[model samples]
Target chain A: MKIEAMPAEKAARAGGRPGSEALQRRLAVAFAGALVVVTTLSLTVFETARRALASSRLVAHAHEVLQVMNGVEGTLVTAQSAVRGFVITGDEVYLRDRDSALLSLESGVQRLRDLTADNDSQRRRWQALRDRLDERVALLDRLVVIRQTEGAGRAREFLRSVYPPPPPAKTGRIRAITGEMAREEELQLAGRMREEELASAFAVASGVVLAVLFALMFTLGYLAIRRRVAQTFGLNAALLSRTEEAEAANRELEGFSYSVSHDLRSPLRAIDGFSRMLTEDYGERLDDEGRRRLAVVREGSQRMGRLIDDLLEFSRLGKKPLACSAIDMTALAGEVYRELRTADPEGSPAFDLAPLPKGWGDAAMLRQVLANLLSNALKYVRKDRAPRIEVRGWAEDGRNVYCVKDDGIGFDMAHYDKLFGVFQRLHSAEFPGTGVGLAIVQRIVTRHGGKVWAESKPDEGSSFYFSLPQAAMSGFTDPPAARGGRR
Target chain B: MNRSRNVLLVEDNPYDVELTLRAFEQNNIMNELVVVRDGKEALDYLFGAGAYAGRDLGDAPEVVLLDLKLPKIDGLEVLRRMRADERTRRQPVVVLTSSSEEKDVVSSYNLGANSFVRKPVDFTQFTEAAKQLGLYWLVLNEPPPGG
Candidate 1:
């Protein structure tokens, strides 16, 4: 049983066992046991009924024996009365009645013998009664014949000779036989009563025992089910508490991130401010060497300011909620390129705008990603060559694939994993980036349930691809032209 | 060389005060520059109390260049008091500090400073800033009408 319960214990520990499941198992066992108990009880009741029936039959047989004995006694009394009447009146009618009583008396004696045949002592008493009845009938017959033939005087003389009113010495023996028959009838009644009492007591005791057993089983089943339910409730509560703790910790981390990003900017501003002031106030007082050193300090502070801004933005990305909306990639890309041109009028890069699929995402964030990628392509292109960038999109596998290809200084594919990591740069200081741009892009894409990857070689151009679900493309506009190039 | 037109420079760091004085010398703006190490001295000079009790209130500086971070009564409060008083309310006050915090800048501007300039860290940049400020405020910019 202990080994069998291991899986249930493991399930409970894992919070997989539902209260209802445990209760159902307990109820099933309880019901099965109840069914067995009911079957056993039915069998016991059937046996008890059979015993009771046997006892009832014995009681009924004893009652029939008593009735037969009473009939014999009545016949003997009628015979005695008829003989007296016939002797007194000397009528032939009394004689006929006495003969009919003698016939009934013989039948009663035979029935008494048949009924008492099972009891040896009762059978002997029945035989004695039969002999006495036969003697009485013969005397009555003799008395009747005398009353008919010798008339009333001779019949009286014959009755006195035959009966003599039961002599004193023979009266004891006759009373003893009658008392023995009465004792036998009483014994039969007592035996039948004892058997009935035994049967009834067994039935009552069995019923009480079965009821107590059933109650005990029911209590055990109920307690088992209750315990299992409590255990399941406890496990669920523990899981809920763990989940709450994890959520609280995540909230605290976010708050800490916001605080760090917000506070670190103050000191960085001071660094940048004082460095610029040094060059402005003492440029003439210092020599060329001092002036160049001041420029380096100013440049370092400016770079630090940019780094801090990028770091703050990266941290804020995790805390900020995304506002999703349908955006036209082609139009959005064109807008960003125009803005980039205005920002950097000296270096204009060529762009090939292909018919792009539109999708739902934060427009501002997506624009930032496109700006970063395009600007990087423009900045890192070979100095001898004019920068060429291509923006294209298409529908594939229930998702829209948007790719930004650039014929610029491409990276080795072996370092692809480092591209999306914060501050992980493949290039040297020549590439001016704080390295948080791709990290922010990856975060936004992941938040929208999309994926971003890049395919590139050392000399050849690189294409950055991102896929967005169809649901994200709900209200996007379709561009008329398939592709267009700009310089 | 106008000795009567004094400039009150309220700054905490001695190095920054030395640098400002050097920048002013390089600009050749010959005016008496009064230096107060903390907000208390600046307040003393304005109220004519403590070490400067017997000084004439009418001889107050033409401009007060206040630094926000000080040992006692910060620059904002000092500016507040200078503006509240009729005697010095019209004094041209400029906020000069190393801090470039938005809150500090906004608050200094809100407190009625004539101009706000962040103290440059590089020596050359600081020299350039001081010369430009000296030419603009002390030479070109006109003072308000007074007796």
Candidate 2:
């Protein structure tokens, strides 16, 4: 049986799924961006609050200034009313009221000056208003003095003369200054109130935006985790079902092989046994052709028996549980060669065995593979000259590759497809084989998670190579046979 | 060699029975050999029941060469029945079959079979196995105390 060469599959590099990793990275970046936005918004909210505080203070200051201006206007009007009452009724209580009103007016103007001190324009207007208030209070006091000293008629005349309002110029100037100052404070108060409102709205908006961002981040993370879990479950379920199917198929195959081994061999035995009995007990009665036919029958039965045994061995190779061990390849090859040599003690093959590396595999299975390969090497040589065989091993690409090269009647590479098939014989007439040996070799190598292939040229030689994974070499003690040295 | 030794051969295949008888003749093992064709007949003969009811129970076979595959009942079931009965529990049974499967060998031993041998396809090998078996069981080894 010829085994066709199969290209080895390169091992896949170890890494997480590229798509999922990119998705995870993107999720991280998005989350980080969300946090940055939240942080920035939080700063915005805090700044708004600070601005609101400052604006609220400005509003309070504006209200205080307006209140102080109104106080000054109220004080001046009360002083004027008290002096008028004193001059008209000649009442002493009215005169005392005028004196107290003048004192209150003085203090009100002084307070207004202090409150408007931070504004240069307001301070100038306040100073002018203060001077006007002082002049108005002095004029009111003079009226009260006139009502007391010159008597009622003269006081009335004096008031009338001054009451023309000094052509409305000086008092107008005082009223205008106070009105302008009050207007300025009112404008500032309105501006500060608007700023407070805007700040409060910004604070609320930022809070809401930040809350939404947090919710979004949480939802995205939850979805990512949920999707990954669901994918894993789906994959696990598929793998579980596939494994069960494979196990069922394996069981069926084992049953078939068992029955084949038991039922088929019995008939073959009977045929061979009876044929031998016929020849032994009744050979004299048969003619030459008859005896030759009987011999043919025995030989046919024996060959069929051999075929059945080889078939059983091939099937059993698939089912046998491997007992793995560390193997010294050089010692193992020597052992197989010695055994093969013993089997054909009359024939000597020139063996060129190179230094072999240690390997990891089932010792018995490996022995079977080597024995078959070496036997093939010894079998297919020309009868005219001695057989030359080479054995070598090397480690490459995480595997140990061993090669058995023989100078024999090599097969055409075109027929390589028929190799390693059970019952496939390349040179059945020339080579005596059940055609299952290379098939058994293929089965054993595959079970070890390895591959087998060959390179050959007709009449030159054939080189058969098999490789075993390096990972299987560890965690095993060397076989006892290997330690016992060459037998 | 004991001339009075008796052997029971249980097999369903006629050709196999002939081949075995021929091998025994070739080996010159001349002890009296009784053949039963099936598991049921073998059970009946061993226990002296049915067609064997009139036979003396004390004249038990020294060894039973049991074949695994048979008609009516299988070898394992027959072995189970034999081991279960007090009358036949101590009788020596050697399983001789074509199957060399690990499960068959293990099951035969588990059912109290004394030995398991695969019937080699070669007649010469068969003759040798038969000779060894007869020399050991009927001639050399002592039977259990008569029931």
Candidate 3:
């Protein structure tokens, strides 16, 4: 069953089995094969049965025609004998017999004519026999008249002129005609019997051939099934190994991230912790410049700590299984805005939250998106102008598109390419951030089968738009809870 | 109080040890806080084995402040071995580590840790946490008899 032309691994699992496409092809082949076998068997059985039926009908028709001809010939011979008897003895019984014989002959000839209506070959021979029967009947009537008027001697002379006595065994026209028709019917009967025999034999032969074909088809089907079973086993093994490999890689990634969380954070804690110790313990010994340097060291370490935390969060988002449900976007946005407002109590941003369309996504992830965007808006407030943030959403093209417009210090449009990139900051330390907020926004949006982008102009304003799919999308599977978790 | 309560701090980092000592001092936890640098030594001290052979198993520390990352057999293993043994089965373990990873907290709790606290980066906050931990485990909460 394995094809040598294919590679070893493929050869083991190929040839109309492993994949869905191959399975369909295999089913189609089986269907076509069965169709061909059944169609051929049906045609053979139908043709044989039709021929057998026609041959048997022919045999019955020939038998009926011969039987009718025998009655006609017997009536003619009996009528002549009855007429002779009447002429010889001047008997009334013989004349009555002749009259009855004439009636039977006439009806018999008419039935034969009707029966052979479609026979081009029998029409001429049967017509000659019909004319001869009419002549003999006319002669018989004359004899009867002679027996009534003239006498036995005159009737004898008339009969002798038409037909000789039985001693001579004369080939009379009526007898000759009937003899020829009988011979023709016998010939036809023999030919029809032969035809019936041949049709019966062919029927039996076709049945045997059909059985053999059935056996062959079954064998082929059995072999195909065996091959397919083997191929399935091979494919299952291949799939199992691939799955193990993927699981191993996933476990390794989990290990890497676990170490990143555990190992990377302790050192930063030390950096920030020691710097604070220096400022608190040796504040009097250090001058103003030295204290500022210590504060700088502490801020840098704290910033690094934030960077690590943000990156870890972003990494975890990829592996975190999503719990999706319909969310009240307006309420969620308002809640996030309230949370952000608590951070900046002195300057309250004019938070215009419109009635948003209901969104479908993981509530926690979407909440994160909202928190990041709103916090960014609140963080980048232009001190010269009052902070004004607008939250609005609308349904579009099987998605719910939400926009967070902030009239704050927007960056130049040229650097928008790096706006949602991780650690790709457009501004320097003047604007304090790890440049992971927009990246997180993009990640969450994309995970929900959506898109995120920004429209901005420097010194004017910026609007961040993100779309969440209205329904489940293909190719976006909720990942299973990560395995290989270690403490 | 001249002596508060006996506490065991399982830690590997020297810097973390110094800071923890400073925290205990600032909080005025006037007790002998025994420190074990690794998981093996912590197990040894708890079960009175290896280097802590012939050590008294009855006057056990009130709380074991454990760190997850260590050189010999990590902190989760230490908690597991402690919980599995009859002598130290009911010992109160508080996981105080810099790693705020979810697995560490969950696994520590699953391994029968009393509490899981992520050590804050700021020394002031660390000091406050140490004080609260001491107050709760040593003074406010009652320890098991003969533990």
Candidate 4:
């Protein structure tokens, strides 16, 4: 079978999906901008509302000034009429009425002056009205005194000169002055009402604009959120269906392998068996070259068998479930080295298993990993020197990395891309293998959520390092009894 | 002693059956060997049905060497049918096949197969395996009383 030459790192890189971080950042910026707009809108509305309140207050002040001015005019008219009646009829009751009106006249003018204090023009008008009222009250008082002390004839002459002299000339003087003040107050009231109306209208317009802006922003945000949700769900559903299809494909491949194991082996067995039978049953009839050729045929069939087994074993690793626990790396390496030494006695390298950091993974799988690396080191012993292998590890930065350094015939670093590829070999014949050991090692380490790589120069010793995450390693530990007996 | 009892070999491939027969002849057992090509033929031979009808109702094979892959019915179904019948439930059957996959071995044992063995590719190992089966079943293992 032609296995693809894709390296593990490149395959892992190809499987990654693009992230939604940019979309998330865009949403955050949009929300911040909307918040700023809403704050500015609220501030504008508050300023309009404050202006409207001040305008209304000014209008109320104008109304008070108008009322005080009316009261002053009424007090002046009452005092003048009472004083005139007293002089004309010589009645003491009219004199009492003139005194009481004159008493209230002073306070009414003072109140009008206080109400118009905020407006300079209205204050000046109030002063003019107060002067008029003071003069009228003084005249009325003189008339009252003449009526009481001297006689009715002199009071009558004084009143005729002041109040009853003409039909509208004397009353029109104070009334015209007060009418000017009241008209001014009324003009100011109209102006303030207009200002209040403009402020409120501005406030209402700004409120409506804010509401429309908010609604537009809300609908936009809601659509954006809904679209994002739809996109996310669509991505999830596609991912789910793709995962199911991949699973089904994996099962189909598994069945294919199962049938291939059964079907292919029988043909190879027949070839080998018949070859052996030919040599054994017809040995005397064949020449020496013929027998050797038949022997080569047997050797070829056996090698093909081994290759098939290795291929099947490589595929089987992908199907096996992982059983993870804390591993004593030192003991595992030592045991794997011991087995290698016993299995192949002639290639016993000087083994040095230094203190290794503990790990977390399936025991049998990791044992296979160690065995593959160590046996690979044993296989590539250079012709010039005695074999020397060293194994050691350390824990750093949430990971435990182990390295197996071998004084073997290392290959060139230029072919590093094919180092962990299935059935890829840099050098053949010198090293006898199907080149699946490193692939299996990489698979096991990758399954444990780890990484494996080799560093070497041609003719220098090679070093293979594999690392496991330490934080995940701390969660599982083998029992004290099982630690010693575990395979 | 049931010295002349029959040995039934259920295998579909012509080449494998020829090789197994050659191995048995080399072992010199000289017992009557009954070879069936498929699972249906094997079941028919055991129960005296179809082609083997009215021949020998009282005769039963001492051992059945069954191969998993067959033409008409697979070996697992044959084992299940054998274990279901009272006449063949206690029959000694050894599952012999080219590939002994884990699932095949598990299901074979689960269906009450007496023994399971992988057929070696090397002819020497194949001959040794045949010798061991012929000696153990025909000479050593005690057959049931009635048959």
Overall local distance difference test of candidate 4: 0.82
For residues A251-335, could you state the per-residue lDDT of candidate 1 as single tens digits? Answer: 7766555444434533544454455556666778899999888777767766765676677577666656777766777887888
Candidate 4 docks with a DockQ of 0.46
Each candidate's fnat: 0.03, 0.79, 0.51, 0.51
Q: TM-scores across all candidates? A: 0.46, 0.66, 0.68, 0.63
C-alpha lDDT score of every prediction, in listed order: 0.75, 0.83, 0.81, 0.82
Q: What is the lDDT of residue B89 in candidate 1?
A: 82
List the DockQ of the predictions in order. Answer: 0.05, 0.60, 0.40, 0.46
Provide the TM-score of chain A alone for each candidate, in the order shown.
Answer: 0.52, 0.59, 0.63, 0.64
On lDDT, the leading prediction is 2
lDDT of the structure predicted as candidate 3? 0.81
Flag regions of model 1 displaced more than 4 Å.
A1-298, A472-487, B1-147
Which sequence of candidate numbers ranks them by DockQ, best first?
A: 2, 4, 3, 1
Output the worst ten-in-a-row residue range by lDDT, candidate 3 chain A.
A478-487
lDDT, candidate 3, B27-119, per-residue tens: 898878899999999999988999999987887888999999998889999999999988888888899997777778789999999999988
lDDT of 1 by residue, B28-135 (tens): 978878999999999998889999998787776777888887888889999988888887788899898865555678898887888998765545566789888888
TM-score, cand. 3:
0.68
Best by DockQ: 2
What tens digits encode model 4's per-residue C-alpha lDDT throughout A101-169? Answer: 877878877777778787898788777777767776677778778988988988777667655657247
Candidates 2 and 3 compared: the better one by TM-score is: 3
Fraction of true A-B contacts recovered by candidate 2? 0.79
Can you write out model 3's per-residue Cα lDDT over A326-352, one digit (the tens) per residue?
667787888777776776677866889
Q: Taking the tens digit of each residue's C-alpha lDDT, what string does model 2 give over B1-147?
A: 222468899998888889888888888988878999999999888788889987777777889999998899889999999999998898889999988888999999999999998998887888899999988998898788774
Task: Indicate whether candidate 2 or candidate 3 has the larger lDDT.
Answer: 2
**Candidate 2 wrongly placed segments (more than 4 Å):** A1-19, A22-217, A457-460, A474-487, B1-4, B54-58, B85-87, B140-147
